[model samples]
Target chain A: QQPVQSPQAVILREGEDAVINCSSSKALYSVHWYRQKHGEAPVFLMILLKGGEQKGHEKISASFNEKKQQSSLYLTASQLSYSGTYFCGTELIFGNEKLTFGTGTRLTIIP
Target chain B: DAGVTQSPTHLIKTRGQQVTLRCSPKSGHDTVSWYQQALGQGPQFIFQYYEEEERQRGNFPDRFSGHQFPNYSSELNVNALLLGDSALYLCASSRQQISGNTIYFGEGSWLTVV
Candidate 1:
């Protein structure tokens, strides 16, 4: 099942912060974050496992709450290059190898 | 190292026709997965291949099929294409053990059905 993302779209000024949320009805084993610029492929940001771990990549970081079946991505001091669509990919079961992505949250960063 | 690579960066086909897309996974990766991404949407998994066999599949219909070769390359074939079939087909690759592993995606093949 596809996950639901909050704030379908967001506009942020450079040096500002923003958060994107992803909620799934199904229990999750792992949560992956990715960003795709216009006309490019989805690029991996980080992954959070079932242990409720938090991982960071540069200015971007994410937290996975297994109990809540949700994950949130935090973009600190957003940059112009941060403009793109952010998607959360969830794995219902470990080793199942299938990742169901969320609808996506469009993030726009302006100078 | 080269990441996942897809063929026919763009294509156009008529409704009711068929089309095939190809993908070569990243180096040192053994498992391949295919996903369909429509405009303004996230990628949806279609199927996964491991050891040259179909290891997993998503909610896609039977009209959508795929094959994986020993070299870990894969193909996605769609029959009786419809306007809705127009989307970007992405090929992702990772280790056979997938869980917790980073899956890399290709540039994707864009298909347009008239």
Candidate 2:
């Protein structure tokens, strides 16, 4: 099943912050975060495994909550370059190599 | 290192026709996965190939098939296509067994079914 993402859209000014959330009904073995600019392919950001851990990339950090079947992506001090669509791909527990993606959250950063 | 590469940046086809898209995995990567992305929607998994065999597949129908060569390059073939199949087809590559490994995606092949 496809994952659910909160806040279909968000706008932030430079130096501001925003958060995107992804939730799935099924247990996830991993959560992969990616960003896609208009007319471009999605770029990998980070992957959070099933242990409910967190990882950071520059000012962007993500946390995985295994028990909650959710993951949250935090963009701190957002920059204009951060304007793009963010997606979370969920890997299920059954060894299905396919990753189910969330609808996505569109983020715009203004200077 | 070269990342995933896809062919035919854009293509147009008639309904009921067949189409084949190609992909070359990232350097040293042995697994390739195919995805379909409709406009304004996230990508949906089609299938995955590893070691020249299909290891996993999504809910896609039999009309959607794929093959991975010994060199780890892959091809996605769609037979009896429908207008609904008109979308951006993405190819992602990663190392086999590298759980949680970041899958690298290609620019994608945009297909327009008429």
Candidate 3:
């Protein structure tokens, strides 16, 4: 089954902060964060492997829960360039690299 | 490197027609995976090819098929397409590994079925 993402969409002003959450009923091996602009493929943001793992890039960071079935992406000091949809992909700890992505969170950063 | 490259960036076809989208994996990569994304949803995995063979598949129908060439390039073929088949077709490439690995994607082929 696909993972569930909270807050279908968010609108923010430049430098504001936002959090997007993803949860899966099944166990997850890894949680991958990606951002996709309009009419473009998703770009890798960061990946959290072990439980309680937290990773960051620039002002963006994400945390995987202790159960390994949940993740949250934190966007801080957001810029207008952050306008896009964010997706969290879940991977099995032991299997092929096929990823199941969440519904996605649409973030619009206004200047 | 060129990352990943796809052909026929945009195309329109009828409901009963067929279409072929191509992709070339990045250098030093031997695995290719295809995904389908609708207007607002996240990408849905279709299949993955490795060593010129289909090693894994998603819940997609048989009408959705693909092949990997000797040069590590791949083609996604949809036969007897339906209106619901209209979506952005994405091709991703990554190196094969025992555990999960990062995959890079092409720009994607946008398909419109009329």
Models sorted by lDDT, best on top:
2, 1, 3
Interface RMSD of 2: 1.5
Cα error, residue B38 of model 2, in Å, equals: 0.3
The stretch of ten residues in a row with the least summed lDDT in candidate 3 chain B is B94-103
Write the residue-wise lDDT of candidate 2 on B1-114 in tens digits: 888999989999999999999999899888899999999999999999988999988889999999999999999999999999999999999873545666889999999999
Candidate 2 Cα outliers beyond 4 Å, as residue runs: A94-96, B97-99
lDDT of 1 by residue, A1-111 (tens): 789999899999999999999999999988888899999899988888888888888899899988899999999999999999999999877776678999999999999
Q: Rate the local accuracy (lDDT) of all candidates.
A: 0.91, 0.92, 0.91
Global Cα RMSD, each model: 1.3, 1.4, 1.5
What is the TM-score of candidate 2?
0.95
What are the per-residue Cα lDDT tens digits for candidate 1 across B19-98? 99999999998989999999998999999999989998888999999999988899999999999999999999987454
Better of 1 and 2 by lDDT: 2
Cα error of candidate 2 at position B69, Å = 0.5
Give the candidate number with the greatest lDDT.
2
lDDT for model 1, on a 0 to 1 scale? Answer: 0.91
Candidate 2, residues A1-111, lDDT tens digits: the string is: 789999999988899989999999998889999999998999999989998889999999999998999999999999899999999998775345568899999999988
TM-score of chain B of each: 0.95, 0.96, 0.96
